[model samples]
Target: MFENFDDILNVDDVAKALKIGTSQAYKLVRSGKIQAFKEGRAWKISKLALINYIMNQQ
Candidate 1:
């Protein structure tokens, strides 16, 4: 997980930053593993959420 990022990031950015596939990122968001909200057909993940996810991973 990355700490430096824009306030909000898209699935594409999350996928690249987390080194995971786009679908995997989506799955995380859909499964409530990563905090995110859907906008139309896209998912927006927050930097704080990503940080929380990383912290909780251990």
Candidate 2:
């Protein structure tokens, strides 16, 4: 199973994992529905944060 917050993922990764569209993934980040950071010119999401968000959604 996946583990740890150090596992940084990109927008596509988040989309695939969550079965969402890339635009929706970006929307989540932009709307604060998810946590992420911009590294250089790319947006990165923490696996732990995604999991936490999913859990809290219930």
Candidate 3:
């Protein structure tokens, strides 16, 4: 639903997109394996960074 690069996606979106668990998505963000930024009390991941990570994985 979020299409802009400036938009931030929450853990649930990332998990659903990547087909991973919510806990795993949080772990990736916390561990620096995936890029995320803190917005208020929540973590937000950039669409660009997520795409880059997927590309690199392949």
Candidate 4:
């Protein structure tokens, strides 16, 4: 699991965690596939949410 990630993550963090590009990270968030929310102008994804997504994929 994501032991090094924080409770909340940004696009770059998500990209690093998923081993994907930042653009793809943004697309995942925007497409509602990653379960993110916007805070002001930035998107925020919870570590638990990402875990859930990965679990569902399996």
Candidate 5:
């Protein structure tokens, strides 16, 4: 699931990739911990941004 995803991922997708809850994923996006932008009522996160975030954590 993590290996294949669209360029922009929804909060649910982020949660699955990180093995976290949707609520926590939303928090990460809301607080700018995970690079994302609001599109209408949805959050879209970049694949590169997610990768960067994971790398930075290490």
Candidate 6:
């Protein structure tokens, strides 16, 4: 579904994809609602993980 985004997405990318605020996106990552891993101090989410999260939400 997210064909326009990169395979690896950042918080801002996720926010745009979900049409939510960056804080909300961060909350998802922090709360483990969306699967993510930290690279240094930033969160990285795979495109497949995002798709899976969306699918599971429905």
* Model 1 worst lDDT window (10 residues): 1-10
Q: Compared with the true structure, what per-residue lDDT tens digits does model 3 show for residues 1-58?
A: 3363345678888888788999999998899888888988899998877877788898
Q: In candidate 4, which residue pairs get closer than 3 Å at backbone N, Cα or C atoms, i.e. clash?
A: none
Q: Candidate 6 has which clashing residue pairs, if any?
A: none
Worst 10 residues of 2 by lDDT: 1-10
Q: Which one wins on lDDT?
A: 6
**Candidate 1's residue-wise lDDT over 1-58, tens digit each?**
3656788999888888889999998898899999999889878999888879988999
lDDT of 1 at 5: 72
lDDT tens readout by residue for model 6, 1-58:
8899999999999999999999999999899999999999999999998998899999
- Regions more than 4 Å wrong, model 4: none
lDDT of 2 by residue, 1-58 (tens): 3552248888888888888999999999878889888999899898887888899999
The lDDT per prediction is 0.87, 0.84, 0.81, 0.94, 0.91, 0.95
How many angstroms is residue 1 displaced in model 6 relative to the true structure, after the best TM-score fit? 1.4
Off by over 4 Å in 5: none
Q: How far is candidate 2 from the true structure (C-alpha RMSD, Å)?
A: 2.5
RMSD of 6: 0.6
TM-score ranking from best candidate downward:
6, 4, 5, 2, 1, 3
Scanning candidate 6 in windows of ten residues, the lowest lDDT window is 47-56
> Highest TM-score, which number?
6
- Per-residue error for 8 in candidate 4, Å, reads 0.4
Error of 4 at 14 (Å): 0.6
Q: Summing lDDT over every window of 10 consecutive residues in candidate 3, give the lowest-scoring window.
A: 1-10
lDDT of 6: 0.95
Residue 35 CA displacement from its true place in model 2, Å: 0.7
**Sort by lDDT, top down from the best:** 6, 4, 5, 1, 2, 3
Summarize candidate 4's per-residue lDDT along 1-58 as a digit string, tens digits.
8998899999999999989999999999999999999999999999998999888888
Q: What residue runs in model 6 are displaced by over 4 Å at the alpha carbon?
A: none
Q: State every prediction's TM-score relative to the real structure.
A: 0.85, 0.86, 0.82, 0.94, 0.92, 0.95
